[model samples]
Target: MTDLLDPVSPDRAESFLTDHFQGVLVRPGDRSYDEVRAVWNGMHDRKPELIARCTGAADVSVALRYAVAAGRAVTVRGGGHNVAGTAVSDGSVMIDLSLMNRVDVDAGALTARAQGGCLLRDVDSATLAHGLACPAGVVSHTGLGGLALGGGYGWLARKWGLTCDHIVAAEVVLADGSIVEATEDDHAELLWGLRGSGGNLGVVTRFTLRLRPVGPVHHRTGVFPLADAAAALALYREFAERQGPDLHAVATLKIAGQQDWIPERLRGTPALFLTATWFGESAEGPEHTAPLFATAAPDAVLTRLLSFAELQALGDHGEPHGNRYYTKSCYLTDLTEGPVGQLLDATREIASPLSAIDFEYLRGAIGDVPDEDSAFPRRDAPYICTVSAQWTDPAEDAGHRAWSRRGVERLAEWHFGGAYVNYLQDEQPGKVAEVYGSARYARLAALKRRYDPENVLSGNQNISPAAP
Candidate 1:
């Protein structure tokens, strides 16, 4: 990685920016820089000398060329939702993509064109109008660029695969300032590297995503009372094993104050909120999965068939743009007893009032994809676990972070030692290699060397060439 600690001074930075770009160029003293530098997480306090709000790919290329020529570090900012605050840096050229929020849907081809800056909800809202949808992040405000590049997962994942799986092509600005379109037929190797590779390759300006016809579907949600955290976890482990592609479900042990839907008994206790969505008829899904839920008598049942749009909206309640949140996620091949016990035991000790332990079932369409076909190699993974700790104060940040880390440590003994990069926050850089696995990590690093040899886009879950 380049030395980003000492960027060019503000005068030179503004002068270089003004000479090449016609869009807004903000500096430290500018009133807009304060707001522009503020990312999704209020915890970050970076002071980039310049922030260039690019108007299009041409402007992006210009910025990239300038950063390299001047030997300056550059950080790309989409929705800026990365919990690690990778979108901004202390002394770097912040390429703000917020101005590139545009969505174009091709109804005939069943695809959507999303600029790098658009959020999940932006694409969903546009595609749903045409009775179509694409796999994206669960949070509505997450940037399409960062999510897709890092292999996004959501409710539609089990049915349609991950966001990277739906990508048809992407327009990327390479290290030396050239623009290229990467797809299966053209720049195929780069396309393969782009998926699940984070932003180590290049700055993706736009993406052509595959879309599926998602009509009205059955949405069954239940909040089970948690008299026994161990029993609830065991039941969830069993239920996830039998779930099919049509059924997308997650079990979250959340704090009482987060939602009113939680059962009174489980309100302030360690409980499970199992939400399932089936794309087909409500009756069929319920009948197929009824035995699983029966394992533990649920205190509240909020199951019913609703439109696919409504189910997407249900998760919208959790805002993606703000609120101090720390998360750790991992993929597992099975819910072994030892790991399951450790998970339940860890959840019982959460000190934060806004923390939660979540289990997202991974099977069906997601599991059907070949490991080497795209950058995502976790097809064999049956489950993805996440510990999300959210709060509203800086003083409470350390406590929540420690709570999440402890959960990860407790579950580490039982896991396969792999994780989901998109859910990683404030963890070691080595976690990047752990998430992608050694063999695949080497391939990703080589690809990173080919496309971003200078490490121009090193702000993300970084990948560099292997040592000689």
Candidate 2:
């Protein structure tokens, strides 16, 4: 029989959690509660009644089981870097896994086993020391757990694959408080679901990732006036298609910031930018990138050789924490003049100067993955567009959100009928099904029944078991 606590009275909740939880237990009034509950996105200013800091898998199991017995839900926080701010829930036991970040790299086998609390920087730093890498997200501060579960997209995505593709195994704690090792041969469906399931199935405590050989990479950037966007983007598409997997790139529509590479006059002005990274020998970078300059000479250009770790952190400054963030993402069937024109119009209407409109080129290794092997959708989609709305003012929330949502609404016609789970904002439950499609969602729902049937872990882009 379960020691289910009184739903009305929580007098004994503290004593019971403190006695059972092996790690630190933080109350609402605790000094670190505010800090611990805080997540990357400033939009979510929530407070969980209890913050159970877990040291390892054993501790996480205790927290999940405690939440059930205490008649409350639980939310897990890895690096707490998700834009959706799904880590903390109101009046729930916020399982703080940030303390469990530890990575072990096997250079000989080209593999990295990282704890779920680990950030992109943790695996990048550890693996880079051995001249190897686990392809991950662009922001180093982003959590490895959420990124992998949702589908990791980074500079090396074209060269290698999404971070989830590198995941060979994982140590996950289920809603029922049972720990299972998911891999190809054992619990195969669970592992398949984890590739892009968006944390709907379990609290993954550890991940064993397959690493790739990567070291110093060369990067080149060309900033163009808004007037020259169509030409530059056309050239960008051709270049990305022509170049081999060793080349990875994207086209961004953003306001010029205070970067040394950017001219002072161009600062705060909207510009179309083309950026690419060469994963091959740094010396051969210029030859491959010369064509990018041929289409339209940039207003200014900057090129540099960066170590894998350094390149991973380049975008960190742009995506600062404690800022209101709302984003809508969709994969485009094509990047024709229509989509490009709409993108430019959207960029001009950005309510916040920090906001950006991005076109990320997909395919290459991302498309090479067999569909049956993982649950990630639209791997074959050639382009993914995201409208990022960032602001600091609470007064203009309505305006900023309206602009951001409308920005995506403009491109509805070109949508490839799929969405990336990682970039999705706080949409309705039906949106989750729409992203995965009926066929794939059905498969995942059947698998959900095996693990989290009751949906104890239903905080994220949930995959409901009872869905039709």
Each prediction's whole-model lDDT (CA): 0.77, 0.86
Q: What's the lDDT for residue 105 in model 2?
A: 91
lDDT by residue (390-444, candidate 2, tens digit) is: 9999888888889878988899999988788887776875898988888889999
Instruction: Identify the runs in model 1 with alpha carbons over 4 angstroms from their true place.
Output: 1-16, 258-265, 282-285, 466-468
Poorest lDDT segment (10 consecutive residues) of candidate 2: 1-10
Best candidate according to lDDT: 2
Name the Cα RMSD for model 1. Answer: 4.0
Error in Å for residue 162 of model 2: 0.8
Clashing residue pairs in candidate 1 are: none
User: Against the hidden true structure, what lDDT does model 1 obtain?
Assistant: 0.77
